[model samples]
Target: MSSDTKGALLDVVKGGVVSVTLFAAFLNLPVIGLPAAALTPFPALYFGLKRGNRAGIGLVLLAAVLVALAGGPEASVLYLGQSALLALALGWGVARGYSASRSIATAVLVTLGLAAAAAAVYSVASGVDLHERVVAGIRESISQALSLYEKRGIKGDELKPFRDALEQGGEVLSRLYPALLLIGQSIVAGINVMLLRRFANRLPAPIRIAPFNSFRNPDYLVWVAIAVGFSLLIDNNVVNAAALNVATVAGFLYFLQGLAIVRHYFETYSVPALLRYLFYAMLVMQAYLAIAVALLGLFDLWADFRRPRKPKNL
Candidate 1:
């Protein structure tokens, strides 16, 4: 058999192990055994990487059925449908060889895709009541926190912060039910990649790019600059702090991506090549910095000097 086939099979076994382990931890493996309830599209994630669309779609259907059974037909259907779509989209990207590794652009795309799809589906589906489902999850988490706080046999102002923090988190989650899926998918994908590599030797490497390549995208630089400049210009101390945090993270992630690329080269090739690659990548990333800033500076000219408007509704 081809190594790829072996890798694919390993993917299935690895995914099953991961899912079953989760089920066992939560539902008691020795007693109820692994819930066939979760055996659907989420697992298709593994299948998709190894196989193709047909296998992926089939897995989705299976997982959807299981999810429906566990979550109640309606909730399960809604969630599985989302999961199926997410898997398909992710699978397609994988098939097309999009980077599955973490990077800001990838992070943004994944977040937007999941959020946009869920928002659209929820908007269309009657009685799905996303807000309510969200509230329920938050309530459960808050309940857990409250349980912990109460167990201390202590009552004081300290408990207030814990409740307040949880409530704030719940508020954020209420609007971002999709975030739960995205976060879980990212986590699962990372774990799956690691396991496949460690055990099955089926791991695929992310396509190497110059770390600074992200900086070359003019749009990216513009938005990042806006983000940073706005942070520096903001009046409120809290907002300023938040802006600084954003700036710091973006700078760090972009730089870190370059470092990662350089390190990869060093490990796979020679030290000289690694240094050269790092230098080039750094140059590539910074290539647009000057131009982006120049364009931003020319904003007034762009606004005040609009092109002649052609007659409309002629």
Candidate 2:
């Protein structure tokens, strides 16, 4: 065979191999639906890496379908729109000769826009008007909260303050749909960064790896350990779920650490047979864990819009 023909055939085979491998690996996870939804950004990145954005439109569409099917009809629009933005951002970067920081900034902005657009589209398309429905849902939620408060038999005056607060919150949920979209966009962005770094090589060069000095950063470790440790202690009911809540956040961090380990090992020296097996094993394990934590995070975000946020001490 001609060298050109041989090389083209090899490339095709490799692409197919990678696609099947990634899809299968992802499918094995329990939270395939949500992670797959969050993963809407990945196929675009893959396509951009392999064939650029114009050619990647079809691939991104396919991932959108996979993601949408899992998130349900309500979120299908948002997922597909985000996927489209991801493709555009990646393609635009390649075409414009964007610096790494510029590409990242573009991706972040596009992700926010796409997420907000998706929310607006979904809100309008769903049978109920967003303003009315959000108000209703918030009221129903507040009533339930008050009923529980009553059962606790709190002093009547104490109940008044709590009830007043929820009444105010109900109004907020009704009008602050934009803020909610922003929160979702932030979440989707984090997932994209994770996927891009772990699989698509979309991050700035000198890709980070493990034995990371950041790992030993005392504050980070201490706070995370405390979060996870506290969650474990509280794992009783709705409150206990915060443990899994802690798990999702903590697990994603570990997932990144594990990915770095694999990268570092490869960068540091030759890949031994045993290490290769170990690396593959870790990848599979982390994929499952990432899925679980992502699902946990999903519920956490859904039930409580604000998880305790802290100002980062730079």
Cα-based TM-score, every candidate: 0.48, 0.41
- Candidate 2 residues lying further than 4 Å off, grouped into runs, are 1-37, 65-75, 82-84, 99-101, 108-129, 144-165, 171-176, 198-314
Q: Cα-based RMSD of the predictions, in order?
A: 13.3, 14.6
How far off is residue 248 in model 1, in Å?
9.4
How well does candidate 2 match the true structure in TM-score terms? 0.41
Instruction: Report the C-alpha lDDT of model 1 over 1-314, residue by residue, as the tens digit.
Output: 99877765566555544443443343445544422223323466556655666656655555445545665576544544434554566556555555445332353366457667777696678657665766897899898878888898645787888888888988766654444444445444444333433432342434322222122223364477576786788688667655655554444344434444434545555668667767656656885643343343334233422234568995
Q: Model 1, which residues run further than 4 Å from truth?
A: 1-42, 78-83, 102-117, 120-144, 157-185, 194-314
Which pairs of residues collide in candidate 2?
Answer: 235-240, 236-240
Tell me the RMSD of model 1 versus the true structure: 13.3
Estimate, for each residue in 89-154, the C-alpha lDDT of model 2 and write its tens digit: 754664566543345446767867666566689777885576566678779989999999899997
- Per-candidate clashes come to 3, 2
Candidate 2, which ten residues in sequence have the lowest lDDT sum? 210-219
Which structure among the candidates has the greatest lDDT?
2
